[model samples]
Target: MTEGSKLLSEMNERSREVFRRVVEGYLSSGEPVGSRTLTRSMSEKVSAATIRNVMQDLEYLGLLDSPHVSAGRVPTQLGLRMFVDGLMEVATVGPDDRAALDATLGSNERDVGTLLDRVGSALSGLTQGASLVLAPKREAPIRHIEFVSLAPDRALVVLVFADGHVENRVFRPPLGQTPSSMREAANFLNAVAEGKTLSDLRGHIAREIAAHRQELDGLAQDLVESGLALWQDAGESYERLIVRGRSNLIGAAEAAELARVRTLFDDLERKRDIVDFLELAEGGDGVRIFIGSENKLFSLSGSSLVVSPYMNADRKIIGAIGVIGPTRLNYGRIVPIVDYTAQLVGRLLSER
Candidate 1:
């Protein structure tokens, strides 16, 4: 038998029950659990002998540890993983939970940052663990374009997006950029690029420029080329990432647990790593759950992520929404919560 299964099959019903209850108790109280603790309590059905033998098996499986202070078994990281993965029965979210998530989606016309803040706060409250909501670095679609020459060496480049957004950037020509070349580049973009994506727009402009190298004199060509390069570089900039729930770290009982949360915050603040986390949410399509140490991204912290990616009208993936909490989390109930939140996000974003 494989390792996980071998460990599980060796576990009888009584063993499973003892382990789950003990783990749950330890999680709740942050204390080591003793067999006498079980005998005197509600789970009194099993003999102390039965509980002891089972607890020993759990220790052998590397799921539980006998700490020196309490002479009682405490859940190891691996133990928590097993309980979260297969033993714990999660309750689905109820109507009240749905209402809580719905409240975060009420404002449809507000900007993205406000929406993200609300999501983070909502998740923190729901999970009682810290939450992080990463926002898209920028949101703009092409609307219209205009080029105006203010002087022989300077020109104003204007861009309009379909979202009724307008941005104006000024660029100085290399030496003498004739107004005609500026107009040509602007006219080409406005006419040919209406429904294209932002990345698509950049590529199209580059291709057009490259396909015809001899279309303008040195000064005019230099002005047009530099302007394109500058905008593309700006667009490549990252999206803002927001992490909420630093307070959760302070409550972790063990120093080891505290270090993990610190490392997680460090990674969440990194643009590239945060982007990877976002991508994981996007790939899952619906709610995705990561158990304790199941992923190195969150391994150090013994945390879990319940995430869902919300979509736009075209069914395009826009962003992810999720909650981060300790691994002892109730996944069965939280799964429904995360799923409902993603639905609300999609509905809110799509509303006219």
Candidate 2:
């Protein structure tokens, strides 16, 4: 076992009980836990003096801290991490919650964006914290591509994926391009780009156009290149991180916690870091927890994230779903909930 686990193992039963009660009490009510408060709750009738001695030992071991000179003690971030990893009893998703998730997320919705929105809302409501989902970076192969002319120099590009999902982008054809050239370009793309992903099509179309440049006029060539490039750009745009229920973070905040909440809000606005953080979960199997000061992204905010990566049919990790809340969050309950939701999202995507 690691040093932390060994330290926990060496704790006497009474000491462990006192420490657990202190952490649980602090988590339940965001306040420091006093020895007298813990004495009344213990089953073995431990004295307040004895509890205070145990708390002092816990503080010396770096598991607890006193915010003020005479105030009660609170669990530090290290203490909370050790409790979550070693001591906490995770709660299973209740039958009612399981049914609610099933009804809400297990619907027949096939649109990925719409499904993510619903998932975020359901998770926020269940956990009473902010929810975030990183959308899949890989896209389905194209089944069809069409171009419709709105004017001599403008058109609409419609992409139909193999999963029956359709996306449209407004296309600005090269100057002096005509309607007939757009139709011809669309027909060529429809024939060659089918059954290929954007990455594959980019390389294949580039080669095909270079070899057959003599067979087409300038406008048609420009339109074909523009259309393919546009589709590739659109695919990149779909790689997004969706956040919901940020207001819930504010609602649960105490006066002193507002500055940290504001910092978290600023961090959310920087999508690059959030995306990078979620991507770290892609290689892991189960739920991953990042406590305050453990990850620099939320260190200043004293926040915690419980994230789990979702997978596709081939067991490839595609995306992640998670909850962001204060360090005092109910981990025993939320860990199982996030794990179950991640599994459900993976299964749904594989089925789709």
Candidate 3:
């Protein structure tokens, strides 16, 4: 047997029962569990002294810890991990939740931002914790491009993608450019840049202008370069992580828990690190669990994440959906909820 399995197997029946009861109690109430409490709940007739001895043994095994000198003991991060991976019983998503998820996410909404917002809100309402959605990073190919003059020196660039998604960005036209010239530039791009990504179109337009500089007027050439440069620089704002229900973190009134929740808010503000952590789930097949300090990103907050990757029609991993809650959160209930939401997200993307 593996080392962890061997450790579990070596525990005697009474010790296992005592350890299970302690973890369960801690998870249910977020409080330290005492030996007397375990004695009362346990089916077998066990004395408080015997339970205390068992707890001491488990603590020595690095599975439990006493938060205070006199207070009852609580499960350590290791203990929680062991309980989740081996001892905990996971529950499936119920029919009502499934129907709610379907109703919320079943829309044919083509706007990616709107879809993700709805997803985050739905997950937050269901889980009663903060929800996160990592948007897809892949850019769709350009099917059409149009430029409309907004002012003497400003214009709106409308890009229509092959997937029927449209995006608009403001562009500053070069000096001495007219509306007719802007239209010409847009037409030229639409004719030649179709099916090419923004990056590819930038390079293609640069080379075309270099070779055929005399074919267009000076203002037209400058306008083309300006539009392409504007798009290339806009890449930073594209894919982003969406977060919702941060207030749920502050639901607990305990001073220590409130402090931890404040730290978690600070962690969420560091979007880049959270995105990198969520990206780890992209390589996995199904739900990925990061319990408490197991992930350095959330170690300070003492929070846990249950994330699952969603894919596109081509089965390419596109993004992730998950919930972030305290270590004492309901793991058994949330696991299947996350898993099912991920599958639903993938199916929705495929249909689109």
Candidate 4:
């Protein structure tokens, strides 16, 4: 048996029952649960004193904690982790929930950034917690490429991908460039952009130019090179990390809890750290849970994160989606919701 199972087996049946009741009660109410409360709900008519002794034993095992000297006990981080990993009965997404997700995410949205933003928002609304969406890097092959002159010096580069997603980037065109030259540049890119990502296209263009194979005027060649360089220089940080529904983190929090929530907000402000943390989820399978203190980002706030990586058609993990909430969140319900949403998102991305 696993260590957790063996440890759990050490407890008598009544102690295990009492431990489950206390955890359930604490998760439901976000408050300490006393033996008196468990005594009333338990099928076995155990005395409050007897239940209290069992609680003390559980506390000694580092699974429970009493905030005040005389107050009831709440599950510690280890206890919460144990409950979630082993005892929690994850609920499947019901028809209503699945339908709601489909309606929210299955729109005709062709823009990846907007779709992912909506995803984060939808998850936050459903979970009543802040949502994190780590979008995949732009890797789809180009389907169409065009250059539209926004001004004499500025031009808009429109790229439509094989997945039906679109991206627009602005770049400064070469001086004295005309509409005809812009058209030539677009033609050159579209001819070779057939099945290459933007980064790949840039390298291909450079090689073609260096080899002196393409017949193009100097101005048009310069425009082509300049536009691709500009886009590349912009890099992948644009909307790569998205966090939504932060206000939910602070909802009705007490003074001390509110302080912790503020700290979490401060942590969220460091998008780089959040991105780094989300990238770790890419290495895991299915839904991954990080409870209080497990992740330093949420350690100060004592928050928890539940995340899962989404995949592409090739079953390759691309990005991650998850929710952040208090340690007392309803894991039994939220775990399945996050898992289903991640799977749905993967299928959607694969189809596109």
Best by TM-score: 2
RMSD (Cα, Å) of model 4 = 5.9
Q: Give the per-residue lDDT of model 1 (tens digit) for 167-197.
A: 6677775665566766766666676567664
Instruction: Write the residue-wise lDDT of candidate 2 on 123-227 in tens digits.
Output: 888888898888775567999988787787677888898978787788677888777777778777877889987767878998888988897777888989887
Indicate the residue-level lDDT of 136 in model 4.
78
TM-score of each: 0.75, 0.77, 0.76, 0.75
Q: Residues 117-195, candidate 3: write the lDDT tens digits.
A: 8888888888888988887654679999988888887888888888787888887788787877877788778877899
Error of 1 at 337 (Å): 1.9
- Count of clashing pairs, candidate 3: 0
User: lDDT of all predictions, in order shown?
Assistant: 0.71, 0.83, 0.82, 0.83
Q: 321 in model 1: Cα distance from truth in Å?
A: 1.2
TM-score, predicted candidate 3 vs. hidden true structure: 0.76
